[model samples]
Target: MATVLPEGTANNTAERTFDSLNPATDEVVGTYPITTPAEVDAAVARAHDAARFWDELGFAGRAQRLRKWKSIITRRLPELCALVRAETGKPEGDAQLEIVLAIEHIEWAAKHAKKILGPQRRSPGLLLANNAASVEYHPLGVVGAIGPWNYPVYTPLGSITYALAAGNAVVFKPSEHTPGVGKWLVDTFAEAVPEQPVLQLITGFGETGAALAASDVDKIAFTGSAATGKKVMATAAQRLTPVVIEGGGKDAVLVDADADLDAAADATVWGACANAGQTCAGVERAYVHEKVYDDFVAKVVEKVGTVRGGSDMDAQYGPMTMRSQIDVIRRHVEDALERGGKAVYGGLDSIGERTVQPIVLVDVPEDAAAVREETFGPTVTIAKVRDMDEAVARANASTYGLGSAVFTRGKGVDIARRLRTGATSINAPLSFAGIASLPFGGHGDSGFGRIHGPEGLREFARPKAIARQRFSPPLSLTSFSRTKATEKLVARMMRVLHGRSR
Candidate 1:
């Protein structure tokens, strides 16, 4: 199996590793390897060696092992949740919530892998009447995944579980900000299946991730900024490795005229503020119908003000996981205010070095920085639209097409369908991410390829199609034993079949 001796284990090279610090507290949590391209190559070679053994185990065997891993995770939920909280500085409840969703995905991937990816019969087309056809999804050997810090457990596990279920060995590079969370995960996997290192962990900064990207992995699954996603793609391009790039987004929420204002407000506040507004699919902008704009904004502010950010147990949320992001959040807020925006709730004063209270801006311009750029913080910009059509047009104006939401009474589902995004929640916000069976991903600047559901399983596996001649046909088009008479007959048959349509 593929394995890397974690830091302080066998390869105690202190100079080559870095500290994993709590961005919220500025305290060192753990130290991990700064993996070089050479190390990445070694890891991928190990994973390649393990992949054959894993594939030979077949679907039933793999599913059993995956279920075992899931059991281990569920049994030790509290410990893992605490580790996540410490590394990411999220509230305990929020950490548990994300881990619970990750567990669901693992369960779903285990139970559905065989049925979704195993060989099945395919229809023989008219041109090959005597041929029997089938297709089976085969594992793509070793996969490399570079994960993000936001929702560390959930985001990375979405790739890791689906890859494992599809019978591929994985070499995971967890974010520098959340190495402890990554260590806990990999250690548990090793414990669950000690005989085979089907899952492995490597830790470091951007250079380590870039090294993995350029390594000889069968496929790359990355969840990070679009800028880094492009770099990953470029590095993988050297080896012609396929990749699934799930990048950032500037998602929006549309509030229709007849929508339930209270529900919309509640969903928006929770979606934008949950995880300290560090969510990739979080609602950063909202377009409300003019008829109910006043009431909707009022409710959003009222609910958001009640939420608090702190490190204690009673707080609703916690500090920002990355201190640098605090400045990014502040820049967007400050720019909006300078461009004639009004702060209905929290503003520049709410942004602290460690934590940021949720900020709500009103009447921000369409071209303003806050509205155009991705502000991955607990912030939202509200604008009044003439109608639902205008709301959707304004929402789709950006270069992002990740996750979106629509709040409406009778036209909720219809409006959601109209939005040009990968996932949409009608009358709810970021709810699609929780459904394990629904494929989660985005398009345009949000990046392509899915990380959940059957699509996700197939992302790490390649389809192998088979065709066999079941029986002999009287008219054999594929045989070279045909004379001019047979050729004439075939032409006549083709004419009969398709001449009228043409």
Candidate 2:
């Protein structure tokens, strides 16, 4: 029998329930109360009520509370990791790493929120020179977050931590596959600020998430599949609500002819197999210079063969949390095989009941589904090119451009900048995710807006510009009293400041 949620739990609507299973054992671990539409609305209303109190606290007070919360999370990091591992079936070490990184983001946001979101003076321009102008960021009241199961802690915390630091209350709806992780985070925040409902959780299936999107929240921050992101945006359009969508990625890693083959292979193995290849920025395709293609493929195959997947401690990877993902992984492998791609390490039979061993493919046609789409599995398709130019062209051919990496010794930075993605790292894979200062997001089909660093704080707050006249100017332009002489002066100033020839 499936587990049932406990009655009278906080935020429980008692309308429906869903089971969270241990991916490794296929045993039901726990049941979460599926919130109804009314409950989602109630959570939003409570967030609005809490926002007034939270916004009134200002930056310093809010920063202090965030610091305290950060301390709490840091001290209990292991406990939280256990919950994450249990709910998401990720390795314990990986879970711990995500929590640590999340804490770093929280600390950084708490320390820098004021500097990033505070009021600042701006030039009123010559036309409004008589008026003093300043702009300040205001809270968006309540923000609703619909997160993903992979990297459950880090992905959602990217939005939640920044939103709270910006003085906006949050109503988080974690992935149905990982509600326990969500509940643990919100419960910890509640312990820090028991007086107000600043952070709340509403757990349920897609309907509950849809309800939250359609509700009256000021903004919605969603991190999931691109398809669901489109649905969320469509629903929010009804009320014309603002949203920041951090969807999927088909990111690639380019290895130039001058690159170190061994280092490139190591990075590829880790990037493709880590977290069971569930990372949004994880490398799904690899473009290698044909000059060194054979050496790179051999090393990657050797390295991937050393890694295995299981729930046991000795294994390097774990099982697929969602059963439906098995079919997708199998189909991608089958498609690649049929399209003339050679599987160097594993094949279609490598996909087990729950665990999927790492699969490395080489000589894959660029148009293959495995190369063109977001597999979100521990599979990588590597192709060969004649030069750096061809490698770059093949890398940029995809529709999604979230995060990418380059492994050349000297030209890594230049190549990284030209990848048409949001974030890129040189010599290392997924290193940008660790830096709290750089903005994390994507472009094109990967989704719009950002959710980390300064951009994240600004995303949760609306800019409010204040202008007040301090003194009368020698030449006025706003009033009807403006003369041709004043217009001529303005024109001359414009020509001086913004002339066609610099």
Candidate 3:
């Protein structure tokens, strides 16, 4: 039987209840507080009230407190990882790695927020020469985030940390499957800053998330399916609220003929099987050079066969966190086989109730759903291409352009640049996610906006431009006293500067 928590409570009272189950055993882990529309409104109101104090604290004071929060999280890393592992049913080591990355982002954002967000002088155009100008980033009063179940800690923290450091109060609504992890993060923030509620949590089902989207928050940061993102944006449009979406991806990895097969195989195995292949940036498709295709597929299949998925201590993969996802994984596999794709390793029988064994496919059609759509499972489709150009072309054919990787000897960086994705790894798989200095986001259907580095800090804050008159210009165009000669001079200057004939 499933456990059910109360629908309404002092911490978070609402009119709905949802169950969070342990995927490994198909048992109820715990029930979370389901927030109603009224509760979501109250949370947003409190965040707005708290943001006034938080925004006034200035970047230095905010950084100091954020540093304290980082320390608390770093010291309790093991404890936090345990919660992550239990809630998401992922390996403990994987959980630790994710937490460490989250810490790195938090530390980076805290240290760099002042420099990236502080006011800086701007050069007013020559047309407005008499004016002194400056631009500064201002916080968007309250930020709402709706996170996913995969990599629950790192994914949400990407937005939560940056928004907080940018001087905005955050009202986060984590996936219902991982509410405990969300509660722990919010509680930790409370420990760091007891004076005000800089971060708050509102838990519930889709209705609750919908309420958050409709609430009066200045911005919404969402990470989930593209379909859901569209709905969130549509709802937010009701209030003319802005949004930053980090949606799904059918990412690819390209292997050149001159690439190291060993490294490519290892990356393909880990990328497709880790977290039971529930990663947004996981390798769902691979376009390898025809000359090296056979060798690469053999090695990847051998490595994948040795891996296991269960609650066992030695298991490399874990059960699917969301039970409903099992059907989706199964459907993709069946569809692939039905469309004349050959599975080199596991077949349709590999998908279980909670755990999905690794499936490696070769000779799959590019148009097959398994290859074209976002499987988001531990299944990868490998195709043979003529050369690097074909590999790049096939990789770029996908609708989702989140992250892609290339394994080669000489032209890895150059090829990475050619791929039309947000971030690219030269010889590594998903290393861009760990580098706090590099911006992390995507373009096209993968989504817009950024979540890491300087771009991320700016995303959370709006630009405030100030211009003051310092001295009278040679020709004052703003007033009616401007002469025709001055206008003629302006036209000549424009022609000389911008309209010059090539």
lDDT per residue as tens, model 2, 311-391: 888888788877778888899889989989889889887899888999998767788889988898999999888887887
Per-model root-mean-square deviation over C-alphas: 3.4, 3.8, 3.6
How does candidate 3 score on lDDT?
Answer: 0.88
Candidate 3's C-alpha runs over 4 A off are: 1-15, 489-502
lDDT of 1 by residue, 6-72 (tens): 2222234657767777766767777777777788788888889888878888888888888888899
lDDT of 3 by residue, 444-487 (tens): 77888899999999999999999999988888788899899999
Any runs in candidate 1 off by more than 4 Å, and if so which? 1-14
Which pairs of residues clash in candidate 1, taking residues 3 or more apart in a chain or in different chains? Answer: none
lDDT for residue 479 in candidate 2, whole number 0-100 = 86
List per-prediction Cα lDDT, in the order shown.
Answer: 0.87, 0.87, 0.88
Superposed by TM-score, candidate 1 places the C-alpha of residue 267 at a distance from the truth, in angstroms, of 0.4
Better of 1 and 3 by TM-score: 1
Minimal lDDT window, size 10, model 1: 1-10
Query: Candidate 1 at residue 66, lDDT?
Result: 82
lDDT of model 3 at residue 382?
Answer: 94
